[model samples]
Target: MKLGIVRCAQTEEVCPGSKDFQALREKTGVFAKVDDAIELVGFTTCGGCPGKKAVFRAKSLVAAGADTIAFASCITKGTPIGYPCPFAKRMIAAVEGNVEEGVEVLDYTHGW
Candidate 1:
């Protein structure tokens, strides 16, 4: 199953604390993981809070073969090393409301 990762719009270079998309891909072993299981195929930012493009982008990813969508733990957990953006909740709600049907949304944070 192909998955999609939606994250904060902050650039990796600018946000040194941002979660590494490549590392996540490697750690999840999407390329080598068991067949038919969920795997990350694409990643993008939420266009920085009020940007409405996140909903469309997420929908497109799902249409393109993403079986699931996920937000990084930091964004949902409010870790000391990382702070959750207020827009994070809004984005998740938007994605949940607008994305394709049956696409699983996984919050890799505490109490998800």
Candidate 2:
């Protein structure tokens, strides 16, 4: 599977997403569901608060050959930051609603 990850823009400075990458490498977390080897096609951040550009980012990742997109733990589970995005649900919905058909939009990469 070709995977694209979207992390929290706010947490990029404090975290380098090592854990997310580690999970991907080990097939832990959301990656465990993938039956084949995963290729990281894209890694980007939602464009700041409210995530108004999340849909566009997700679309861009899909256009870049990503068949599946996962919102990272920083955005959903809060990870190193300990503060989940307030607009996470809406951003996920908007991206899911906007992406092409058959594109899988997952809620998170490594946590609930």
Candidate 3:
């Protein structure tokens, strides 16, 4: 399955996302449960605060052939930073509601 990753804009400065990408490529952590080979179709931020851009980004990823949209641990689980996005739930919900039914939404990309 092809996937897209969404992260918090604030975390972008400090986190290069190499760990998350590596985990996905290695099928480790949260990606271990997947049986099929996963491809990264997109990697982007929520455009900051309120995360209104999540919907648009998810849709864009889906259009680019991503079947799954995974929220990075930085936003959902807050690995490394120790502070998750307070609006993560709402942003995830909005992206879920806006995307097509076949598109899958994951709460996190990789584990700490």
Clashes of each: 1, 0, 0
All-Cα superposition RMSD per candidate:
4.7, 1.1, 0.9
Residue 92 CA error for candidate 2 (Å)?
A: 0.3
**Could you tell me how far off, in angstroms, the CA of residue 23 lies in candidate 2 after the best superposition?**
0.8
Q: List where candidate 2 sits over 4 angstroms from the true fold.
A: none
Number of the top-ranking candidate, with lDDT as the measure: 2
Error (Å) of candidate 3 at residue 36 is: 0.9
Q: What is the C-alpha lDDT of each candidate?
A: 0.62, 0.91, 0.91
Using TM-score as the measure, which candidate wins? 2
Candidate 2 residue pairs in clash (backbone atoms < 3 Å)? none
Q: Write the per-residue lDDT of candidate 3 for residues 1-112, one digit (tens) a residue.
A: 9999988898999999988898898988779889998989999999999899999988999999999999999999887789999999999999989999999899987788
Question: Tens digit of lDDT per residue, candidate 2, span 1-112?
Answer: 8989999999999999999999899998988878799999999999999899899999999999999999999998888878989999999999999999999998888863
Ranking by lDDT: 2, 3, 1
Candidate 1 has its poorest 10 consecutive residues by lDDT at 25-34
How many clashes show up in model 3? 0
What local lDDT score does residue 50 receive in model 1, on the 0 to 100 scale?
Answer: 65
How good is model 1 by TM-score? 0.68
